[model samples]
Target: MTTSSEPRTEPRTEPHTELLRPDGSPVRVLVVDDESSLTELLSMALRYEGWEIRTAADGAGAVAAARAFRPDAVVLDVMLPDMHGLTVLGRLRRELPDVPVLFLTVKDAVEDRIAGLTAGGDDYVTKPFSLEEVVARLRGLIRRSGAAARRSESVLAVGDLTLDEDSHEVARGGDSIHLTATEFELLRYLMRNPRRVLSKAQILDRVWSYDFGGQANVVELYISYLRRKIDAGRSPMIHTRRGAGYLIKPAEAAAA
Candidate 1:
């Protein structure tokens, strides 16, 4: 197996739409790999998509974690120190029969891919693959399996402003607004909690997936960027609460 000299820290330009379980909780995923580095990298990437992630290092751990995590999806490594990944998949299926599984194989042979699929894996990605591809594949699998619903299941609206999570489209007062991936995630976080103050700490944890220490100014910078696109030449919907944090509400509502 080969590792990238420099792994990507940010996801490629794709819809940052959030997916959730039928109960409106974050979608759960299990990642089984003997490599700690690979598991950590995969977990961070998946969390940025707003999905909860659990990792197991071997076939036995994978099966145990699956039963407890009840993951909507699984990313199983084809090679494990303890047992074959196919064996882990078999046990997982016997317990949670319908969960989607995406195999991670170091081999690129056609037969290997077919074997995984034939063994009930929903999809497969070889090593040296892009993190974006894995995320995209899992998103497709979860959606197709009926395990989770995209935010597109319902439009998030705060007054005249509307954001479609599924299409990654935003509009304010009937006019379309464009946002970068980071900007979109920040906006979605604020919109999801309308009229409620969210501190910089919360925003950093939720949107960036890491604490910035004394460098929380990144939040201010992105909030300014969002203001230009979302509030420019209009009655403002996004508001700041002085030392508190930020909030988004209808202009009229804020006026009241």
Candidate 2:
């Protein structure tokens, strides 16, 4: 399998929806692939979405990991060194009948896709696929399988500022605010940890999913963008701690 040639530096601004289990735990996923690099890449991407991930190199390892991990979803590679992916799928279904499975294959043949679906995969993606597509597919699968549920309050509020995870809406003091996908993600992260400082390294790793080789200017750039929309013409809630990082609090709390 080959990795996509697309640049990975830019932060994914997609609506950052946090899916959790009914008990408010991270969604668990098991990824099965022989390529260590591919599994690592996939693990990083999924973890950024706030899902717990475990990986296996072959069919036996996949089954063993699934038995222990009890994943809500599985990303199964069609070609395994020890066994065909279809065999693995059958074994998985027997144990977790309702779990969603997404098949990854190097083959683009129609028969291959049909065979995977016929064997009970919930979805399919060919190799050289984008990480964004894989994460999106897994999100959908997890949601549909009844494994993930919207939090009791889909909206997160810190004082007057509110963010609706479902609608991707942001507002301050009853006034509507607009944000780019990336900006929304940044704001959400800040609001999620109100009053706590988050370092640039932490922000870069969680928001962008990788290190920028010590280039953290992107964080500053996006923070500026958020301040413009979220704090302009008002008592600022987002604040920088010089060398520390950034944090968000209520306007009243900051004033106090």
Candidate 3:
């Protein structure tokens, strides 16, 4: 037997970031689901992975947490107390549209899956989701969003107008447009989901970061802001639907 004369040393593994951010801090995440146990489990798992995590039980809470956390990503459940996941996504698309959302729910119906994606969710992991899979998907979404953020300009263009989320700046052709912080975020969401019809409720929830509790008129005010700077005396790029919602697109205007 060899004599025991060695210092006990714990093996070290290569360092890895749980949440990768250019800021060099762990990425933040929000988990919105009604299942308390699952939410806690996910929270623990994410924390163990070194990512910051927050939880919400209802749609309202989800919206608030998302806005406050400004999470790098969100894990959402479809059946929420106040609203459905689709509605939440609609709101997010209006405010924090580019922030990737990963949906979690027991609803495995194909239609539900399609609906979530159609509403702008980045990915969907049905209930009974594995921790490993959740982590993988979260990483994938964060990576994609981060890459998008780094594009030479976080500016998305259509026709002669461009909306830059990173800089909170808008430009028409070559002229820079000024917008308030909220207005800039709204315009950026619209630009990212170009040509998509977004409802009033969606706009209110996403941009305002909380349900206006029925305030749909805020969209009109901000749209006016965008029009004054981005479309006034120019071709109308942002259009409103009579009974539907608002959409941003190339002037090839259609009912959609």
Candidate 4:
């Protein structure tokens, strides 16, 4: 572990602890790295964003800190002495599956990345990376995930179905529904455009980032994923227009 050449200040209490808005709270983050100097540097950058920050130099400490802090998300290192990052992540998934994970490691191989994702990483950033880039990536995850942590009644309803945007919980006929991260985003977009036709290409453009593998089929996959939860019983609210694309509206919403 290396120390930063710059001066350090005593850490402050995170502002986000009091924040409970759908717009988001100041992020609570766990920085796990074997290098103390790099961890400090990253912590400094994250603090400037007014984020609540904590640091761990090894996998064991990372797990302990995470369990105690209960951060909104984590920035993990792939290498650690006490245990491998992958092992820590597996434990994290079982204990805190909803917390978004961003892996920062030197393992840049494609297979390494696939393994991380399979192990439940939400995003990955290779080491020797820019602090600004890490900050940006972390912000994006927080924006998407912060909703699920708060008690929320703010909802968007088209007909019989409802999506609590603040809570990120979906329901139909008053029963709860669980959706993956991507499925939530896709449904949010469709609900925002209720009764309007959204082409697969448009859905791909909005839901997926530019760097994602250009697989249009991902839209098809998630749409089915949504249906199993949102439309498995009763009449289907989401309809496929054989040649057109896809659209969502309540049968009553259509009449209205």
Which candidate ranks first by TM-score, i.e. highest?
Answer: 1
Per-residue accuracy of model 3 over 116-175 as CA lDDT, tens digit each: 888888899876666667877887888878722222435456556666656666777679
RMSD of each: 9.6, 9.6, 17.5, 17.8
My TM-score estimates for the predictions, one after another, are: 0.63, 0.62, 0.51, 0.49
Pick the lDDT winner: 2
- Lowest-sum lDDT 10-residue window in model 4: 14-23
Candidates ranked by lDDT: 2, 1, 4, 3
Which residue ranges in model 1 land beyond 4 Å of their true spot? 1-11, 153-256
Residue pairs in collision within model 4: none
| TM-score-sorted candidate list, best first | 1, 2, 3, 4
**Per-residue error (Å), model 4, residue 114:** 0.8
The sequence of per-residue lDDT tens digits that candidate 1 reaches over residues 147-247 is: 97665544766667778888899998789999999999999898776667899999999999987987889999999999999988888878989899998
Considering lDDT, which of the candidate structures 1 and 3 is the better prediction for this target?
Answer: 1
lDDT (Cα, 0-100) at 130 in candidate 1: 77
Q: Which has the higher TM-score value, candidate number 1 or candidate number 4?
A: 1
Expressed as tens digits, the lDDT of each residue in 30-57 for candidate 4 is 9988888888888877765545689998
Stronger candidate by TM-score (2 vs 3): 2
Cα error, candidate 4, residue 171 (Å): 36
